[model samples]
Target: MLQMDPMRPLDPALPITPQLTQRLRDRIIRNHLKPGDRISETEIAKVYDVSRQPVREAFIKLADQGLLLIRPQRRTVVSRIAYQDVLDARFLREAIEADIVRLLAKTRDDALIGTLRAQIELQKRVHADDLETFTQLDEQFHRMLADAVGKAGTWSFVEGVKAQMDRVRFLSLFDYPMALLIEQHTQIVDAVEARDLDRAEENARQHLRLMLDYLPGVIAANPSFFDLPEGGLAPSVNTPTLGGEYT
Candidate 1:
């Protein structure tokens, strides 16, 4: 663990606050900072060779984003990833993505279609070796479709939710076949290109549903990663529901 002093000054060259915030956020997302693990501000300040003020500020930002929990006079820890929160995030993503597909189907924007095709080609190129690159292209493919339909805002909202779920997806990749993801994305692109609105929507839904189905296995594999009430990673009897409107 890195340490930092609250009284020291940050480097003159760096944008201390945002840089630290992103680094900490990445650490949390990558499970380097596990759920319930304590974060020491002074330690962070030392690690980054900066003052405690920026570290404290970064902690507050992370807390506001539901990524950290701050306790007065006690240790601050990475927030537990809640089942309800995961479900809600998934629902939001599905709603927005489904809508984006529907609108693209209706509009049939050639430019967007071309971009999607190019993205698919890129995916094929990198799918064999780089999962991170493939994942980024997958995100861009969907965002391109949304942008084509003038629904980029919806994509942005969906992106925020997706980011929350990415850790689970990353874990799932350890157990699931990447080929399946590639195939699914291919099917979605085919449906969209064919102008089959219903098929496209169903494909998108199935993609999300597959992810939801894999959550149990992910939790089981990484019991310590989730912040469940009892039995930690065991499935809950009252499965949380996720769905809502977004402007």
Candidate 2:
């Protein structure tokens, strides 16, 4: 029952493993590969007319990102989102971005404000149903702030740690208010432009904390997609029923 959209032929000239890794990551994040769905290295290899070696490499990379579960002598499956992982990622993001906005406010960069304003306009133009495009724009908006402060590498590190958070976000995109999100983006930009460091930092922190407010509802609506206990905490990793056993 696993269905994937048609993928373009792998470029013969470029390295294959990273390409496969990114493509497979996209499929996983977009829900094309649901949690607990079994996947075959051989099938994916054949899909791109490649050998299994690169496919295996891609699987291992994704497993490291907590997006894929690789079991020895068994099928590889998409991982259910770990509640702790999402919380930890949001914590890290808020810590970094809140400071980034405050720094921007201190500097009061006109060009940066202009760039963010343009980005906000682009976000508003995305149709409400076009969650994928809005998500991309949202990332771009944040990355622009980081880039303004020479923290692009830091942003990359955050990106590496946020796969689980991104999965939950993609799930909630349909119902989450895109307009409110855009407003938050505007608030941060406005605070920075006004050179109010305290207000900018607070706005950034509040914006990032929206995930905490939204996560419980997302989990309630899609209980099967997460690995959470009755108390709403992440279960120990060694839990046999959800961990060792592959359903």
Candidate 3:
């Protein structure tokens, strides 16, 4: 069983229900609550020193997110990560990101390009010693790029899907080379600065491809983290066919 710190702080401003819901969601994404694990609202309330009413409300929110399944008779379990869902989410993300790059190339925003360059430099420095900070900045860099194209809302949708893949990403961080990621970001920035749409798209595609390539190894090492079919493992969300064309 995965153990979690009971004393973790809740978002003080949020209603107790949403606070609990977000906490549970975080636990699930962080791999502290594995798929198909049974979760009891009563137990959670007790653990968090909260009332059952709040826990019940939280569970409902989680169920709506597809992170939890509420069965008949008040039982709830963490939903298994569906392979098709992952594929669909990745497909949408790739399409949106490709569009982002095309828009960015046309705009040629020097200020935004400079910000991205600074982010890449920070990514290199922190990645060597502190992966946690590097991960946060890495996410910011991508978001910043999308924002530059006036697609922050689109990127938020992308992020919702990406959240489902966080566990796999966390696992890959242990084995994958961070230097390669930095280099990929740098190349994309260079292409954008040159106002080369085709080259920027190719670079972005390559960066996502690297992530797709790493999925197999991640699943191999942490089989329990994935939702594999009975007969064989499923392909990752970032399959070549899905991301090949801009939609």
Candidate 4:
């Protein structure tokens, strides 16, 4: 099961369509709803206690993100993992972050250094069972590195394109050892502290490639979560069954 559940009531913060989109997106990325798993609008609408209109809207949105596949006269299924998309995201991220780390290494800001070390400490301290928290902290550490080099904008852009890779990361989390991630993070920090741009760049590249290394085995193990390209179909709005709807 995903650590988070989508069936809960909608958060008050967002509009209905986006709210539903996020819940479904989280589930798909987190592998709570594995790829290739059929998702019935009727069932989801009933489970979330929402009208079919919002759920259908959310379906189109997720399909746009390459997370869901909508087919006419067939069941809606999760999109299969697209390795090409994964590679593209990683490539863009490396191009952006490789420079971020290089620049961050050239400067020696004590406060930033302290922050990097503190984040690494937090990474090490994160319990093995809490993979989700560790993943978030990992993102923060990279964001901090980007901000240090005034490349926050670059990081934002990389994040915007990493939706597919994010799912691969979540899938690979349990399949591979987390210790390697912690160790890699530590090495990256060590290189930064030493002001070694060459080493830092290499470490960043290697760290980003880590997911790619671990993903094949996971995909093989969870073969059902993927599909080849296909056509799409949109459904007309209708009232939902089982009557309750969450945002």
Candidate 5:
């Protein structure tokens, strides 16, 4: 189908095109819209109750994010999940966030800890079924860490480079228990508070790798949604494991 499932309806927190774009992007990230599925401006416009102009604009925005492949004089299709893209994102995030945690570990910021703990508490209140809120708070927790370390711009850069990884992450969240992720965040807070650089870094690394552990099952569930990892002989799903290349 052209349109995909939404965690909920569009928030309308922004303008028409931006709002529609966010809705469509959320669907793409969550795997409600599988790769290679054709979607058109008219189709989406009708659904969002917006004009074709805004919908067309939304398509361009999504295309920029690597979520939509826009072809001239043809319908836009959701892009395939390239395993290499996911790996790149994971590697980059591990590099950036682990250091952010390290920096925060050196400083004494009770306010920062309180803020992170608040986000975690909010996460705790989010029902297991509330993927939308869970995802928002998840992003907030990470972004807040960057802010605490005066690396908010760095976090934005990491986000810019990791669009593909973000999509893979959201898709994989379906299989992972959110509660476990929350607990991991709690451990990270504890490690940082204790000024345990090694422990904090390890926690960050493990938390990022959590998605890789779930990738095989995502591929198994929706093979069409993914592509082979770079330099790999074949897609891992058909193999015994995802292979050491990911490690």
Candidate 6:
């Protein structure tokens, strides 16, 4: 059993499985339950004061997400980060969001621009150590862009694919370049405001690719957290042309 702080009591009215799944996911991503750490349904049930059935279901859900590895009559351990999964997630995001920004740039909407700028302001105010709040705001910032262009469902798809990237992100937050990211956000907003479709697309692509630049350092610093071996090759991705047609 992993020793940690007591969980806050779950509400009786809510469904326990989804809540438990999400909380457990957060624990894994935030490193409270680290990679390769063995966790058991029986032990988790004891911590949450819930029955093992819900805990088992929750574990299965996370297993499907590649966060847990369940085995018969063996200890279940947290999955290490898959470098390819992270790259694939970034590729999908860059493809989807590049088009999203281009569409938003084609039309000038002061209201949308204002909302995004306000979001950046809020992001700036987050304390450097408050990564959880910053992460939420960051998601909101991108989701708002997709929502503005009536592509909320498309953004939902992005969310589904980005879990692997999120784990890497949370781990990298200790040395996160918050100011640089905020500046990138500002540039993205500025491009859209100016109706620079190509620039907006480019800005979005560059922002999404920041992980590509930092991932190597992160892997080196915490080799045990990732599945990629030392000297493993990162995936090579072709840069998409600005305003390129989506296949």
Scored by lDDT, the top model is 6
Off by over 4 Å in 3: 1-4, 127-129, 234-247
The TM-scores, one per candidate, come to: 0.81, 0.90, 0.84, 0.78, 0.80, 0.91
Clashes of 5: 0
Query: How many pairs in model 4 have backbone atoms within 3 A of each other, for residues 3 or more apart or on separate chains, i.e. clashes?
Result: 7
| Rank by lDDT (best first) | 6, 2, 5, 4, 3, 1
How many clashes in each candidate? Answer: 8, 0, 0, 7, 0, 0
The regions of model 2 sitting more than 4 angstroms off are: 1-3, 234-247
Worst 10 residues of 3 by lDDT: 238-247
Better of 1 and 4 by TM-score: 1
Model 1 lDDT tens row, 74-171: 88988877766777777777767777787777777677677777777777787465666776777777778778888888776675555458767666
> Which pairs clash inside model 5?
none
lDDT of 3 by residue, 139-207 (tens): 888899888877899887786666666656766676767888899899999999999988887788767
Poorest lDDT segment (10 consecutive residues) of candidate 5: 236-245
* Reference-based lDDT, each prediction: 0.73, 0.86, 0.75, 0.77, 0.79, 0.87
- Model 2 lDDT tens row, 16-105: 999999898988887888999899998888788899999999999999999999998988999998888887887788878888988999
Question: Over 4 Å off in model 1, which ranges?
Answer: 3-15, 127-129, 229-247
Scored by TM-score, the top model is: 6
Stretches of candidate 4 above 4 Å error?
1-7, 40-42, 49-54, 72-74, 227-247
lDDT (Cα, 0-100) at 142 in candidate 3? 86
Candidate 5 local lDDT, 1-247, one digit each (tens):
3544434455566678777877787778777787998898878866766679988988898888789999979778999987777777777888788889988888848888898998899999998888888999999999998998899899988877787787777776768789899999999999899998878877887788787778777768767677775554243221111233334
Cα lDDT tens digits, model 6, 107-213, are 87999899999999999999998888998999899999999999999998787667788888988987778999999999999999999998998899889888887
Q: Write down the RMSD of all candidates, one decimal each.
A: 5.2, 7.4, 3.2, 12.2, 5.1, 2.6
Order the numbered candidates by TM-score, best leading. Answer: 6, 2, 3, 1, 5, 4
User: Candidate 4, overall lDDT?
Assistant: 0.77
Residue pair clashes in candidate 2: none
